[model samples]
Target: MGQQYLFWFAQVHDDFRIPELQSVAEIHGFDLHIPQDLDASRPFCILELDHEEHARLLARRCILIRSVCEFYARGSTYEELHERVRQQRPRWSCYIEDTSFKFIVTAYNHTIPQARQREVVESFSYMDFLGKIDMKSPEIIMTCFEEYPDKHGTTRPKDEGDGEFKEVFFGRLIEEGSARPLVKKFDVKKRLYYGNTSMEAEISLLMANQTLAAPGKLIYDPFIGTGSMAYTTAHFGALVFGSDIDGRQMRGKDKQPGIIRAASQYGVAHCIIDLCTFDVTRNPWRCGELFDAIITDPPYGVRAGAKRLGRKSRQDKEQPPTSPQNIAFRRPDDQPYIPPTKPYELSSLASDLVLLARYMLKPQGRLVFFLPTVTDEYEELDVQSMLCDGMEIVANSLQNFGSWGRRLITIRKATTEHFAPPSFEQLDNVAHIPAHKDFREKYFQGFKKSDVEQISELSDQG
Candidate 1:
């Protein structure tokens, strides 16, 4: 008689390419077998009876047994075992004499048909059989074949049906039963400003397209406002680190609690570090650590606090005091109110992005971030310049969430040997300049008339 065994695969993200279950089995010296014609995509596998001894060997080595057949030793034929039991007792009939032997026999036969083949030396009794057997002490119990159904929908019988059984591996069962449920109770999407419930599913698909970092590679996010980008990336098994200049935005009364909740829900390990409070116009990122990849969404002007309606006044003559012109503005009612800092000029945003690419990214590493179109005319030009500065644009696509139209840009840092040549469009041109002259003149004093003339001359020469 051969032993029987069961195999199963653990759930994982699509980006995790290794077949974890099969590898584990092979390591333990079990003959790996898939059900005949089983789809490779299916989540389970069935090793047949041919490798029974090998299965038992692995099971013992791997501590796979949930229960054991203590009363019935392995490799014992049914009739021979019964005869041996009869020889041990001289007056076994006395035990069955008072019990309903017929009923016991019927139930026992229904469960294990091998019982019927052996004649009872004394009259068979249900109470006697029940008293002799201990269900809880079994190291491995034999199950009827009626339970397992194949893909063709045919089920094997208890007796004549190969007695095919599935062993419930003790450790694996306990681990699965004790594991936390994947879906969280809260409406995760509702917690986000423009998030949808399908965002997780969509991100899972995008991560599948990229090569996953091995378990310890660091994934960084600079503009991690609510931690969504970090949360999604960490699901693929990378260690995530994130920072934001405005810690208040990440830790606001309403927003901070949500970040905590999301981190709890997703099982992402992270640390919130400050990216420094210097203004983007005056300072570049000073974070010393480099990352394998960076993915984030910077603030877009749509629905910004500066665009909110001001307080209504009873007297028409009451001009709202506008003396503090440089003060950042915010809507008090909104969670994590951001003071209105000077708006980002498109050229400055592009320049800051280029700087981030140079400093933060590892050679040949990737970056995926969202860039919104501030103005229609500059959309294509901004994208082109970013790509021309030694970054390879792998994917550029539209992301529509609520009323905002966002462009998702995926760029890979180029190695020195394969550095992308700077393009004509990337040169200082009028289209790359700020739209307001006064703001430009005050903030961009470093930019020279000669530089502007040089750009114009280059444009004409092109």
Candidate 2:
């Protein structure tokens, strides 16, 4: 058995909290003994780890955590909590004689008044610490949390005095979560170069964490528009390579590409190995097992649809001219040639991405990306159908947006065995149909019904 620790998490991104914690733990080579009955709606949970260092590591890497603490006592009432503290003094009393400490009072679904907080702190005064209270910088910190009933989606003002709590937890604080600040530091709105499709800072940082981005790792982003994921991964010391079907998204009409310029903005230019332009389905790389991980946000045709090099129809596929005079000629000053492309379906792209990962990723490397889908239509099979041989899904966290949602999927290369790349014919018929097959059309359909309903009401009034 390991030491039990209390994990206090940020209130936002509830769905991603567990997956991010699991990924960080796996990256550091440890298993977290999480309680099976954990509640996602609560901001805090108790987990068991081998050492205090493991808890600190999680606080450092997990963006969703607010703090990590050494668990001491938890009870439904203050009297019960105090009694438990007296009973558990043997585990925590050693530091009371020499350490300077301060108590922090926090509530999940409500705010605690400062006056009431002081009284709550005084309630635990029987521990009889001999050291002076130091508020500026304490050698030790004590945290007390009051778990309130979930008041999510309601806007009522908090009541005066301490409201009823479902439970109270007391602990010695270990470390505050360090990764949350990176969200503000990498805010996309503050970046030098970003397009409308650029990923938000927090989500990109989460994606980077899922890839286990760290020093000396080589990460590639096939749909690297404006290099959103590239910057964060590089910030974490990973070497990044980015490519896109359209060059303009990265270059943005400048001699110095926007990807490199933004990389410089974050002082991580050296970590960006290079940026190239090519259709992912027709990529130029001839090597295999080169990348440590492939992380990307494939276009979902919302703001911009994904594209590939091909004609819209078979009849539009033209062959080179055979006759000498039949061939078209260009002058020295003629406009540059532009390749034709067609809409790349989300389902087929996902299947091909898995195939590409099988060929390009190092053994045990990861593939982390986002897939948007109609919420009601999504199923476990939709993701399972996309997995190729030697690959397995590790995490699938959803970011819901009412009628639709995007899943931040983390798939791992499970085995070192190499599998033959599927032929185009085989690729076209891979497994069950994904929920995101016609997501763009379905997403719009959700809005159309509401508009139709509004018109019907107007007609009835008329």
Candidate 3:
């Protein structure tokens, strides 16, 4: 049997925990066996890995995990736990002799007071080691975790020592997560250049993992506003190329492009090949299967609206010169000709993005992006409708924001076959009117205007 490793994950982004773990293992080419009854809502889960190196790889790459530990013993009560630890003494006894160690007591739902924390540590005195105590540095680090019931949606206050722990786990620390620091390192607030819709660091790192970004791989971001995913993907050693419909978003009043500026800020500027301005539907690429992965966060008409290259109205369409003398004069060099654009529908954009991924991504390559939807109207089948013939969904994790939520979708190109572009009828047959239709409209009107007004009135009264 493989060695069991307990993964203590950060409580944030619970839905992304398993997917990130699986992706990290897959990217490193390792076998990770997750338990059949794995509960992601809880902060801890034990996974079976072939070696300690595999656990270290997870710690080094996975952002959701806070730390990984070698599973020692676990039980619902301290008595049962002590018995298990005694039975497993042969496995851990080597560290008990001449080894400087420190113990950490932590809880999931409820905080353990300092007095109780000392008592809990004293309870483990049965394993009498003659080593000195080291809080800053230790040859061996032991951890005890108390898991209480999930209190996510509960509004009631938690009192001191009020809840009984559902379970307690004991383990020897393996490694603290190395990737968690990248979140603060690449924080958008600290970035030199960022836009209103720039993706936060944590989610961007999660998307990068979903893409399996690694050294020598090439990735593309179609809706690269301020180049959020580009930096994270590049930080993983992947070469990144990004594009946006509006050049202004990329240029950002600086002589150098904002994306490039931010990439330089993160010390990954060399990995960013170039940032271009073009409508994704009318991209400049003339080839297919050119990138290892395509990762992005497509605009859903919230903070910024999605746009495509086209005439907004018939009046803007090209008109033939009625006479030879009707020729238009060339404008001054200071003014450049700008193409007219039209609103790109969210539903159509989603289907087209899948088609683009099928065409651009290498076989077995991944396409990771976020799609926003109304919480009430969303369905599993809605996501299924946008997939192409050679592509399949790998993971779909949601980040809910009450009335509306954005789902981070990861799709993989499954086949090596070079299929023709999908026809309009084919797209029409599988298309579903997404819950995000008229999202910007409903985002304001759908939330019940009276409720908002009432809240505002209450705020004013206070």
Best by TM-score: 2
Q: List the candidate numbers ranked by lDDT, top first.
A: 2, 3, 1
Per-residue CA lDDT of model 3 for 372-449, tens digit only, reads 988988899889977878889989998999988999999999999885543322244534676766676667665555
What do the candidate models score in CA lDDT, each in turn? 0.42, 0.87, 0.86
Which residue pairs of candidate 3 clash? Answer: none
Off by over 4 Å in 1: 1-187, 190-214, 254-258, 270-289, 305-340, 374-382, 400-404, 417-462
Better of 1 and 2 by lDDT: 2
- List the candidates ranked by TM-score, beginning with the highest: 2, 3, 1
Q: Which lDDT value does model 3 have at 106?
A: 88
Off by over 4 Å in 3: 150-159, 313-333, 421-431, 447-462
Off by over 4 Å in 2: 153-157, 314-334, 422-431, 447-462
lDDT of 2 by residue, 371-437 (tens): 9987887899999988888999988989999778999999999889876554333354555777898
Shift in Å, residue 163, candidate 1: 45
lDDT of 1 at 461: 100
Task: Name the lDDT value of residue 242 in candidate 2.
Answer: 92
User: Residue-pair clashes per candidate, as listed?
Assistant: 9, 0, 0
